[model samples]
Target: MCRWMAWLGQPVLIEELLFNTQHGIVDQSLHSRMGAEPTNGDGFGLGWYGSGEGPGLYHSVAPAWGDANLRELAGHIESPLFMAHVRAAIGSAVQPTNCHPFRHENWLFVHNGYIGGLHAVRRDLMLAIEPGLFADVQGSTDTEVVFHVALTFGLREDPIGALERTVGLIEAVAEQHGIPDAVQGTFGVSDGSTLWAVRYATQGPARTLFASSDADAIKRLHPDNPRFARLSAEDRLIVSEPFSDLPGLWHEIPQSSAVTVRHGGVLEHQAFTPRVPVSAAHA
Candidate 1:
């Protein structure tokens, strides 16, 4: 339904990942080979942390490929951590607020998935968002709601735990609405220091998710490449698809799994299951 990428590590111009990579998010916007749709032209968004208080956000209803502003911004902004996404609207309207890479204070989140039968259960899900966090709901897309649900469930405290709760609740509600196999997609979230990416679906396999190997290892493997030398060992990237076909550069995240990327580039993989269990996620 969408395509996204999150970068955490050495500071680099946004262009390095958004535009420079062979199959960067920008390219994927129009020529996506892995997304459910080949083109994610509905909208786009960019969230990055600089020397600011929180994070900087720029969103638009324009296709990423045709947005001159996006190109210019990417060329100018350099960040150690950021998230970007291109949308291919499924059931939501195309609006600036509905774009991915949704933000809240110091956190940024983006997803490439769908909540099955969202319309049928949207009201219940929205009502479930903690009233305190519910005020931030500015968009009408299920993706935005998912972000808030995670927040309500305590994403600020534990990204992995909160998300498991978030998904569990959604599936619980979906089942009540008679929607089977209610969730599908890959999700990425970060708080400028730690990053979490999840791949999951209620029934069949979820969409694709991949993480890059240590950049230093890449440099050693391709010593002749000048680009590799500029990368730091701490550089890490989690993407919906490989940026390139370079051997040993990317590893696919397992189904129903999550990757935790710490500030120092330490990577941890773990089996992520619905905390609420299918039949008892709800009281």
Candidate 2:
């Protein structure tokens, strides 16, 4: 598994979260608290949206903690919306293409769990992807497959629905192979403005996910906390774990739920149950 974070709001230096937090993503690369593994040193990636460009990405097969380029870039670059992920390969090749925050156009996607028995279902799932997207599949990882699956079902038009269908299709195929609990992940996707975070699994238990509280509320609670005061109510963050141990600043996303963060900072969570029920028959 892996650890990741998504930022949507003011264009602040990436260091603010990559290094400045009490337990930042860089730190998590070596000591993650809730990931399936503590050290996600296989690879890492960062994606951000600039003023006019759709999105820019930086990926490396280096351990995030030892990557000097990451530190230098984080200190210099800034974006209103950005995504960072630390990877721990789940039976996939450890390479740059497999590094996360996978991008297409302005959209960026990342995952924090695995698709069980991916090796068994890989061929079937890959064939189901649209021919155009299949041609663009550069990586050999379940995470990339999930991204293309969503795109195959129309992620650009309706992210939530497309993702739902993608997961359903995965479950359907996995069940046919007698693989139980085939899907397990906390996923995040953003199109520069709005962000959608999902916590779901074929089994009942899913990975941990959290979202920050209203920036305005945090400001009122800690008027002197310069960091809180600097952010507007619209600034929002979704993460695999809290960046800081700020009490009451982060809320755990309920299991099987999807959270949407819109432009201007409004955040909402909705309960999400997969349309195709997990068949315990194969379990």
Candidate 3:
């Protein structure tokens, strides 16, 4: 498992969440509260959208807490949308390509869980990826494979559906190999605009996922705080755990559901169930 976060709202320096917050991603890299392990230091990555058409990405095999480059870069880059991830290798190599917030065109993805019993099902799942997308698979981590699998099934057009399909296919393959409860993860995905936080598992409670309350909700909870007063309705932070322990600041995402935050404060929290897509159930 790993720890990660995604931000979508007004432009702000990356360090605001990466380091400056009470228990931000940088701290989580060293002391994650909800991840399977306390330290996710094998590798780290950051992806953000700026003036570029596709988003910029930075990755390293260094522990995030020890990466001075991450410190300096976070202070300089400001983005309206960004994702950061710190990895903890379960059964994969600790390398650059295995680091997350993986990018493909304008999209970036991060995940906090792994394919249960992957070694048994990896081959079959990899073969299911469409040939065109199969070539873009750059890392051996299950997170990267999940991203490519979603792309293979139209992630660009229907993110939620594509993700569900990915899970469905993984479950199908896992079952064929006599593996049960084969997937667990909270995926953070974005296309340089809308951000989606999806939490689900094949047959058990998924990993912990949380999202910052919208401006109005925060204001209602903390009316006297100037910081809460100044927030725009669109400001949102989705993370594996709360950045701060402040009550009412973070809302736990319901299991087997997703929260989609679009431009202009459009928040859609909907139920998510992974079903074998009729089109791929037999494939």
Candidate 4:
């Protein structure tokens, strides 16, 4: 239902991602070939970490392609780590609060899938949130709730575990409501220095996720290509689809998997599964 991209490595003007690529995020806003819905015009958001305490956020209830202000900001901002998302409303209001890369302290999250039967079981999920974090709930979208649920489950300490628990909670509740295929999405979360991306579903294949493989190798093949100049060997990208149609440049993350991107250009992949809490049965 949406398209998003995250960058980690070298600080470059945001337009290099928002506009420069052949089919960058801004291009996907109007013609996303891989998203469930091709047009993600409902709203858009950008989160970037500069020389600040945390990431800077810009969200608007306007299409990414149509917003001149977003373009202006992208041209000026340079960040080593950042996320950009273009949204397609799925039965949710097109308000600024509902647009993503939702933020909590220094963490930012974005999703490209929906929770099934959310209307039937939203209350159950909300009540599952730790009271301390529940107070931060600000919108009606499932993505925002999922982010908080991850936080409630100790995302600050273990992102994979928190998300496993988060999805487990979503699926367990969906099962109680007799909802089929309870979860389907590719989620991306970052804490300024590192990024964690997950692709999972209860009964079907998770949504699309791909990461650029070995920027250094790509640079060797096209040393004159300017895009490769600003990026370090460790700089990598996790995107909803291949940023461009370059052969062997994008590697698809396996189904039910998580990819972690850290400094020094390191990327690690691990199989992922939901962790059903013992208390969930009683809840």
Candidate 5:
């Protein structure tokens, strides 16, 4: 349904990752090999960490492959952390507000999934959001709602737990509505520092998720490839698909799992289990 990529580690011009790679986001926008649709041209967004308290955002209701503004800004911006996405609208309209990398304070979130029967349960889920956060709902996509739900459940203090609750709430609500296939997708979240991702689905196999192998691992895999050699050990990429065909350079995150990229490629992996937060049941 969408394509996204995240970068953490050495500071580099955004274009290097967004435009320069052989099968980068731009390429994915036009010819994604793994998304539900090959083309994710509905809209696009960028969220990057620079010299600011929170990440920067740029969204457009244009196809990512042809967005000149994105190319221009990417050519100039250098960030230590970056989250970029090219969307393929599911049940929502193709609009800027519905773009990925939805932000809340210092956090940014992107997802490639849907809440089954969202139109039916949207009202119930909206009631579940904390009042303070409820006002921030500006888009009608299930993705935006998921981001806010995570925030309502404590994204700042506990991302994994918050997402667990977020998914749990979605599943519970889906059950209430008799929608057996509750959720399916991978979620990426960042707080201007570490990058985290969850690969999950309620009733089937989760969507694809890949993280760059350790710098050393990549070097060993492609011993003489300078492109792999130049990157710092800290530089890591988490993407929907590997940007290139280099074998062993990308590790597929397992189903029902969570990964954290931090401290220079010291990837942390954990089994993800979702349970409804107390509020989900009542709301």
Candidate 6:
């Protein structure tokens, strides 16, 4: 598995989330307390929206903790919405193209779990991607295939629905191949304004996911903490794990749920289950 973090709120230094906290994303890259693997050294990537561009991406087939370029960039660039991912490479090659925070136009996506039986269903999944989007697939990872499948099902128009359809398709193919527990993932996607995050697993157990408490509430609760006080209510962060040691500042996103954060900082959570039909064999 991998570890990732997504930020949406007032523009702040990228390092604030990547390196400054007690167990920031950078720290997690080297010593994740909750991930199945302690060290996610395969590769890393960062994606952020720019002033007038779709999104800017910085990816390297280098460990996040030791990459000098990433350190330099994190120190220099700042965006109100951005995503960073450190890879552990479940069954994929350790290549730049396979790095997370994969981008398409304005959308950015990252996943923190593997597709069960990926190799077995790779051919069917690949053939299912729309031709135009299929040509854009540049990596041999199940994560990339999931992204393309979402695009094929109309991610731009309906992100949640698209993703549900993609998961359904993947599950269907897995069942046909007699593969059990076909999907296992905690995923996050954003389009610079709205963010959609899901914690789910076909086997009913998924990786950890968390979202920061409301900035205003935290500020009120811990008036002396300058860090929390500095943030506006509009600021929000969602990560694979808590970035800091603040006891009440983080809340675990329940398993089998989805969280959506809007531009104005309103957050909503709901039960999330693949709406597509599943076969008994697949389950």
C-alpha RMSD of each candidate structure in angstroms:
1.7, 3.2, 1.3, 1.1, 1.1, 2.6
Residue 235, model 6: lDDT of 84
Better of 3 and 4 by lDDT: 4
- The local lDDT score (0 to 100) that residue 149 gets in candidate 4 is 84
What ranges in model 4 sit over 4 Å off? none
Which TM-score value belongs to model 5? 0.98
lDDT of 2: 0.88
Give candidate 4's TM-score. 0.97
lDDT of 5 by residue, 1-283 (tens): 9989999999999999998999999999999998889999999999999998899999999999899999999999999999999999987988889998999988999999778899888998888888999999998899988888889899999999999998998888889899998899999999988999999999888889999888887887788887777888889999999999978888899999999988576799999999999865654
TM-score of candidate 2 to 2 decimals: 0.95
Error of 4 at 197 (Å): 0.2
Candidate 6 versus truth, CA RMSD in Å, comes to: 2.6
lDDT of candidate 2 at residue 241, scale 0 to 100: 89
Q: How accurate is candidate 3 locally (lDDT)?
A: 0.89
Question: How would you encode candidate 6's per-residue C-alpha lDDT over 1-283 as one tens digit per residue?
Answer: 8999999998988988898889999999999999989999999999998697798999999899999999899988988999999999877789989998889989999999989898899998887778888888898888999998888878889887777778888888888899988888798999888899988888867999999888878987899987877898788889998987767888999988899988767789987767553321244
lDDT of 3 by residue, 100-192 (tens): 889989999899888988989888778878888788888889988899888988899999989988898889888888989788989988998
Q: What C-alpha lDDT does candidate 6 achieve relative to the native structure? A: 0.87
Ranking by TM-score: 5, 4, 1, 3, 6, 2
Model 1: runs farther than 4 Å from truth? 277-283
Task: Provide the clash count, candidate 4.
Answer: 1
Q: Model 2 misses residue 272 by how many Å?
A: 1.9
TM-score of each: 0.97, 0.95, 0.96, 0.97, 0.98, 0.96
